[model samples]
Target: MARDDRAVGVSSFEGQATSAGQASLAGEATGTASASGPHFAAGPPAETGEPLRHPPHGEGDERAGEVSAGGRGRPSRAPPSLSWLLFSRLVFPGIFLASGLAGLLTLREIVAPPLDMPRILSGLERGGSARAEALTQVHEAILDPRYRDLKADPELAESLIRVLETELRQPITGSPEFTVAYRAQLCRLVRELDTPRTVPVLLIAVECRIADTPQLDSPIRRAAAEGVVTALERHGPDCVRSVPGGVAALCRAAKDPVAPVRAAAAAALGHIGGDEVCDLLREMLHDDTDVVRYNAAIALAYAGRGTGLDTLHEFLRSENVRNLADTGSTESVIGDRTCKLLCRALFALDRLCDRSTEERLAVLHPAMEDLCLSRAPEEVRTLAMRVDLKIERFHR
Candidate 1:
């Protein structure tokens, strides 16, 4: 008799239904699968005379292969080969990587600007369609380290200005936005290349007019004048500032009917003097626009002509500067102009007076010193302090 074992072998005899009997039966049989093999299960033989039998348990013998703890048979599944394992792991990741690379390559084309700087600039030099917009792209290229030679060359700068002028002189045929773009590029070119050659173009730009267009509708004429003034306003290299003709151009521009242009020209002339500029300044003093006359007086005084001494003198000691500290404004434009006059007056007085004007300047220094000691507008106060420093230095 034998007892059931692992709940997998049912007892075949009534006498083999106990746990102890099962252990005892398993211990008794050493060979059951073989004719002489062990019967490790805890169960009784079903037949009375035949030898006790058990199911065959071998690696792939389906008759009685691997079995569950509950005595149920199970199927064997083969493992994948090493080569197949490697292929499956890599193939999916490889597909994803290729997709990402393709996407990046496509995106780069959409995002990156044209990289061939020389080609872009060449087209700009030739004044291709809508060149102003092209320059906005090439601006970074011009500053790129690879384009050092172009940036260093004065001739290249001059050539760009020439092309810019040609474009400005042409008729506006496209969108007004395009016209604006052309104007913007022109300003950028002037500012970037403050070379002396640009001065002439700037001067020409000031008076540039389109034949049939009304004054308000005239893009070229308006942009040209603005561009000239902008160029003059820049603190650029002496190569541009020291060029001789700029003085004459500025002297003429000072007489321009446009007050802003005239004011810009006056300021430039004061900065860069000429034997003729003083007379121009003297003439500007009579102009109807107060701003032009005011700037001219300051320019002349700074140039050591002493011609504006009375104007500047009145400016330094005037009650207007004193009044500015208390009020928001008087007549707003007049009050604004008054502050500007004082600021320029102080700057002019800071300049060294010529031998011819020394006596006049010396007499006014005491009154100027008192005004410097008083409270005033920040710009005026700053300029006044600078003037005081110059006077202190002069007396020493």
Candidate 2:
């Protein structure tokens, strides 16, 4: 005897006996089985020798049981609600994408950190755009209040000094324009630090010479010379004394072919007093460049030597003082240069005249009087008047 795997039930339909076993589906007996005489069972056709089979528990037949409980034929699954479909397709994915972005942002903060001296130095060592970028960060940090005292950091100052020294020792590779600019920026930052320890590296910059490049006058050297002046001014004579061969370095820069370098070197020498420094200023007074001569004269005055008084008197003479003023307004560089030269000369003259012999004042008084009478700029005349009054006090 064959055992039935499915439940068997019998029902009467319109005076005919219909067996549920004769139907191929759960509710197939409701209409089609009643109209047609009898239907085969759900498993297979009656002609086959195979026994009828039912799906095992927990299979797709569970839906069939649910339909049977509702007293209806098997129904199609209900379509997803509009809101559920929208959430699954669009809203959920959007939320997931936002979460992913936030995670990445947090990770980035953890992986890459803020800038510091060691990192900046590493970038500088690599050269090229990285070096330029590192300098830019240094500039920004300089403006930041928290980092304004970077010069006070001994380790950082030493690191920067080494960087400047290395760049000078090795001929830089890469685009000329880029390399020049990078070196210029690096030199400028070192200068801004105004630390006395940087004097040696700055001296190297003043003497830097690139092989095979036209016009050996490097902007880096000019910036370095300016830095030397700043450092000397801030730290005084002790700053130059601390470095080996410091005075000799200034002498080398004073003899540099570049006029600006000589001018800066001459200005830097003014901070210290010595017969040797006075002699250097006297030699620089013969320089063909007017600015160099002017700086040398001022430096000699700073060294308290009256040797520059004659040079100062010449700077205040009517023709030299009024030449630029007549040709162009004080707004022009030439006019401004003349005006500044005159003012500095007057100031230096007043210093030299203090407790000075009549011979020195006698030579300087005529130049001051002429400058006051000349068609010089207001500021120049104003300073000349002050010097004239100071000289008058000596006569009184």
Question: What's the TM-score of each model vs. the native?
Answer: 0.50, 0.59
Best-fitting candidate, measured by lDDT?
2
* Tens digit per residue, CA lDDT, model 1, 138-177: 5765665554455545755765776767766787676755
Error of 1 at 382 (Å): 4.9
lDDT tens digits, residue span 130-198, model 2: 876777887777655555556676776776787788877777576767677767778888887846888
Score each candidate by Cα lDDT: 0.62, 0.73
Model 1: ten consecutive residues of lowest lDDT: 30-39
Highest TM-score: give the candidate number: 2
